[model samples]
Target: MEPLPAAVTAILLDIEGTTTPITFVKDILFPYIQDNVEEYLQKHWHEEECQDDVRQLKLQAEKDSGQKGFVPIPSNTEAELQVIKGVAANVLWQMSLDRKTTALKQLQGHMWRSAYASGKVKGEVYDDVVPALKKWKGAGMKLYIFSSGSVEAQKLLFGYSIEGDLLELFHGHFDTTVGSKVESDSYRRIADKIGCSTENILFLTDIIKEAEAAREAGVHVAIAVRPGNAALTDEEKSEYHLITSFDQLPLQSTH
Candidate 1:
């Protein structure tokens, strides 16, 4: 791997396939959301937060449906059960498509809180992650996470992590609300938020498009190649520095 820029003062990391295995998200988290959505919605539908999420879901469904325009699911007592069922189906479909809608992420985070609290779910990080994070922090580098998951979800994952409460290590968290990960402007915004020059932040991810976008925005970037991650194309391999482990990161002492 190429040397990280000496000017780098902050490290922005992607969760899935970078610090955490991709299968944990696809196999464990997604399936948990799918299985629990209906029950959660049914139990919480009358609450204000649940209603708000349903409204947002309806809006996204309309956008997804295009010119046809989405029909509102009736919410009256006689029809509310069917409405919940229909909305649950839409949520599942969105999950299947891996849509990064804010409302969907919020709802997922809400569900995950219960799961994590009840001991049904715990976040997983690669063996090297905690030590690497500690080393970077000790060297005075700020750490942040930029993931498609909601900021709340990001905190929950690290807070309930298998490594035990890694949340304190992170300086900040960002999600799609900031912008899509593949957009150059998002990296620029993150750089601004962190009060660092674009050139002084290093972005790490498993996706080639995200690495390209961050690099385009003037942030140094590296592609993580982890087990269970998609194989990189020859072109991608040629384009970005690839690190198979966090221990390979070229973090230098700031002092």
Candidate 2:
């Protein structure tokens, strides 16, 4: 694939694996959530949004397991039930399985917000991210973010970055609300929001499924493999434009 042109009006980027390292989320963010889930739910139970999500989780759990009510896990005790309000905690724990659950991610943001404000955590961005973002923005490309992470957490991550408030670089944010990044529909939704043809938008991510989805939607795609991360397979290597460094790409405007 050719390098992006200055004429490409919008730039859509992935968060966790592209602009940020996968390790940071896997090692730092998920663990933080696991450690704090019980406490966060207890403290925030009174809030309407929290209560609503908890209710939804209960319903979702029933739907997922085809059970009439909250199915007791191996460790469902009165104390554990109290932590998540009976059925909700089990649902929350189940959400942690592949780390794909929206409820888990939402709960995680609540925890991380506290962590960031208390100076216990800061967001990590790739070394290439800031400079490349600055260069693109300076050249008049409209930048946007799409991640599985909730928009609130996305803001928190960028707002509390080691470089401080890199949120200025993005004009918009999106999460699974539109659709999962692995779905072609997500790219189509994002394209509509950005007021650009999919072909005119460039989507960067480290996950092949997401890149494949974007490519299927007619967007340009690049696979980012960060340092100390698992390498893409031979099939993936054959299928996508793979890069270890942002600098390796022809980033400058060719137009």
The C-alpha lDDT values of all candidates are: 0.87, 0.76
What RMSD, rounded to one decimal, does every model reach? 2.8, 4.0
Clashing pairs in 1: none
Name the regions of candidate 2 deviating beyond 4 angstroms.
1-3, 41-92, 99-102, 228-230, 252-255
Clashing residue pairs found in predicted model 2: none
Off by over 4 Å in 1: 1-3, 58-74, 79-83
Q: Give the Cα-based TM-score of candidate 1 against the true structure.
A: 0.86
How close to the true structure is residue 73 of candidate 2, measured as C-alpha lDDT? 30
**Local distance difference test, candidate 1:** 0.87
**lDDT, residue 151, candidate 2:** 88
lDDT computed for candidate 2: 0.76
Error of 1 at 9 (Å): 1.3
Top TM-score model: 1
Q: Which ten residues in a row have the lowest lDDT in candidate 1?
A: 67-76
